[model samples]
Target: MTYRILLVDDEAMTKRSLYKILTGANASYRIVGEASDGAEALQIARREQPHLIITDISMPVMDGIELIQRLREDGLDMDIIILSGYGEFEYAQEALRHGVVDYILKPMKQEQVTLLVEKRFDHFMKSRQTAIIKSQLIAPISSAAERIGHELWIANEPGMRKEMRSLSGLLDDTEFMQEERISLLRDAASLISNRLQPQFPHQAWELPYEGQSYGQASESFAAWLDKLLNEIRDKRNWGKRGVIQQAIDYIKTNFADSELNLEKVLAPLGISSTHFYHMLMEETGMSYIAYLTQIRMDHAKELLEHSDLKTYEVGQRCGYPDYPHFTKRFKRQVGLSPSEYRKNMQQA
Candidate 1:
């Protein structure tokens, strides 16, 4: 990722020199804006919110100390580097107290500028890595626990197991040490326990999972979750059948409506199109349209054999709005046109 830097100084020459040094030293460090004074720097900071700000201590307008204080007050946590001359040590010390990362002495050499920026970049990268690792471990555990709650509420055992597998898979994928992995799993188990505790007060479980390997802890947690879900399923009455089942029922009842479609049918079920499609395939061994067509064709055959309704009326009753298309679909599925099938059924 490109790190943005804002340069602030009263002297145009100093700002230009700093820009040249940064551009030559690091391609990833981009100079987003320059300000002649700290007041202008604050204005640009509000707009740009640059990753780093390099500012001179003394200027006509609000100086670096004031800028840092204001930015802190505004809750903007930007890394700052103060520029100080030989006699400005006291100002540099003040900048440090105000959370400046480092101060650069004036009459700065290219090497000095390059080294300071490089060190700041290194610090930035390390901080980012730490945040990433922390988030990676924390977020997935919360997500997995939340998923467990949702699946349990829906009385979906398979979905619950799927979430458990995902939780385990997350631990497997991380590059954490054995101890760290164990700790992460323990944390996850604790979180999951908290979520399920209110529901399963008697079955409050604890994991002395410290000495256990990552795989063992994961397996233990998965088994415990499976048991908890089973207990929940046995106790509570859930909502109308799972989303896919509700969708299937909707299709069956509305099959004769020519406008009945995947989108319209599944919209009320609140399942995504892809998920609805896959569930139809998995549960019924056919795509949604294919299953709907099978139902329509079967019902059409019943109308043809038993009812006195004409073949066109049978087609219309079975959700085929267009006569030719209805005839085409009937022939394709039943190996004969509707009229021919009716005659054969009558002869039989």
Candidate 2:
């Protein structure tokens, strides 16, 4: 990639000579702007955001030192090379304190200029590539944490907890820089909380200690997550029984509605189909439809024994409006035709 260079000097001839040497020495280096003073260079720096800045120390209206201080204060990260005359050695020394990459004594040679640019450019390229790779690695952790959160809330099974623990291990991976890992702690916590907490409004989990160092914060976050998961597991265990009881009550009252399905049953409870399915299997060892049919058949047996309803009418009262379809299902489940079952009941 072409790296941009900003040339800052009070002399137009100096700017032109440096520009020509940079453009001629390397095809990868492009002079983006030339400033007559540090003030102009600051403006150009803000606009162009050059990868490297070559500036003279002696200039009117914002000298190089003041400009360096300003840029540093604003937290702009750029490689800077200072230019100084032989008599301005003190200025070069001071520039070194301000973190200039290198200083060139004036009456500069083409070779000196080209060599400094080449060295700085290599460092710049390496730094940029490292940053890009780090971001790529950290990017996927967000979505993975979100998926873990969904499963954690949907079911507090041991397998789900293991998956969550594995996701937290990503933060400990060495591929991320310390600062990136620290920042990701906040992001991971926020994502997990947003995904899981809405389903359990009373459960509270938050990242502890903002501004802590990466190692300290990561440890604290891991501990907090473990504690939060345990609390969630306990609460889910208590609430799971209540949730099933509530669903059973709803099914008993609404079994004959003909429109009862899993979605409608779960809508009022604000639970997902996957979660509801898991809960039913865990609690009753039956699928939702099986349980519903069992309820309907139990009630149908009561009607057959004590009521005078016809076979088809009895089926209709159990949420089956189609007579043959109801008769087929009844026989498959009961091993007798509905009419025969009613007849057997009469004899008994």
Candidate 3:
């Protein structure tokens, strides 16, 4: 789906330059409208309901801050990015307080724009997917599966119960069939089973209806899912092993991120680089670099065989933005260059 963007700046040049920069960065970003002032921007925003709004903080009539406040009052949940000149740091700070996602200084750099836009959009997609998971069964379930895995990884029994209780209405509502719901849940669980220890066994996440049916307010269904999550959490084992598993899971989920690295992975887990490396090697019998390389290479091979993405694009998605480096690594790991691999697979 094309993500719509709205540009708000009094200067025509500013809007023009930003539009050029944005559309150049990604083809999927469609600039829906441009407004000169904050009030005009607000009107376009309401009419369009854009996914992202890039607005200057110092527009006349209705300043960006006031516009943002008005948007909140009107219950608009648009993601915002503020544009500010050198002295407008205070306005940017206030914007951040109001949940502006990020700010860009005047004269946007190409590298910075590409990085920030992709990062924010990636997060926006993830949040959108989570909202879908909460509302209904998303088709294929792979998009929402990682979220379920993460939730199950962290949640204990009581917390899982409370979280699943929010979905009790979905469980009880006749709007969705039980088999459809269970099928979605099972597909998500199948994706989640990858994070399990080598011996958690099969059918662990299945809902048991031996004694109860959906007639009982779906309380049983909710409780069963909660229990299943907690059991998975226990198997994940929030110890040093859990840290390693979390790192592995992060690697698997974010293999596409070209900037992901050991420091980034361990930053949230509160573990040092040396410690994590050693622990990962000792516990899993696989070095951190080896595992990351294997994961990326596996994904690279899959993309080469299954999709028609360009070799460089395939490399980028597998965390190797440098084409030469990616080619070198692919040849070393898979015994063929990416293009060669694709050619062979397609021919076969």
Candidate 4:
């Protein structure tokens, strides 16, 4: 992957030289922006949202340590490297405390800097890939358990009941490899039992069969199973109130796209417009439009606080067709307009 870098140094010549050397050494890397001082570096870092920052220890306005502290406070995740001419132990200690990835002395070789950056980039990619695989495995295991729970509700046979009881006992075992799967099954069973509490006040096996025949018992079990599965599936569906969270994840991945909307969102879920709206409200406790507005506003706040994106560009990136609407919603949610929020954040 091509990594974006930001170079910050008080000397224009030093910054230009370092940028040229780094870019020439690695075609896979790009110097996205350069800053003359620490203050300007922070602005460029936010606006460009570079993957990495290389900065000098001493600079006018804001120093490297202060910039790192401020970036951490704002929750920016860019990696930082500090450069200094003198070997000051105190400055190195401070940079380490602020979680800088590397500290290099001035008059350093170009090869040494490039090697350190490449190592960090490789580590970041490996960790992210591992997390994605783990999440994928958990989802299918949870879904399969939910299906088994639904099947048990419909069967309600003596043998199946015995199996469920056995399964519930094994759920707490530390030795089980499929712990998430078993926990999901236990949750589904508990939910079904809760739903039938009014009718079958006692345990499932203890329910009285006063006027009911065997066929009625079977029918009742089938109906209950259908209702339970529907409830689970509805809550799990991405288009309903759950869509609020889905919308957040979607926006995070596609925030750069300027035309994201409710229609495009509904297309993937394959639900009717009316049902989609109601489900979104039920799951998220807000209308579809309201939820979408909240997401856009929240994203605007992040950009205003962390990135140097102009207010209009931030609004456009967040899917606000009108800049005025974006400003209005941002003010309503954050208690300040976008520009005002940015000013307050910078001041703090």
The best candidate by TM-score is 2
For candidate 2, write residues 158-250 as lDDT tens digits. 534654555556666546567777766677778777776555553444445456777687567666666666676686574547777688678
Instruction: Check candidate 3 and list the clashing pairs.
Output: none
Q: How many pairs of residues collide in model 1?
A: 0
lDDT of 1 by residue, 28-67 (tens): 9999999988789998999998999999999987988998
lDDT of 1: 0.78
Q: What is the Cα-based lDDT of residue 8 in candidate 2?
A: 95
lDDT of 3 by residue, 209-326 (tens): 4433345424544554566665655654545467776887788789788888778888889988889888666544467787788768867876786798999999999999999999
Which numbered prediction scores highest in lDDT against the true structure? 1
- What is the C-alpha local distance difference test score of candidate 3? 0.72
The deviation in Å at residue 290 for candidate 4 is: 32
Q: List candidate 4 stretches off by more than 4 Å.
A: 131-135, 145-348
Candidate 3 off by > 4 Å: 135-348
Candidate 1 vs candidate 3: the TM-score winner is 1
Shift of residue 92 alpha carbon in model 1, Å: 1.5
Whole-model lDDT values for every prediction: 0.78, 0.77, 0.72, 0.64
Better of 3 and 4 by TM-score: 4
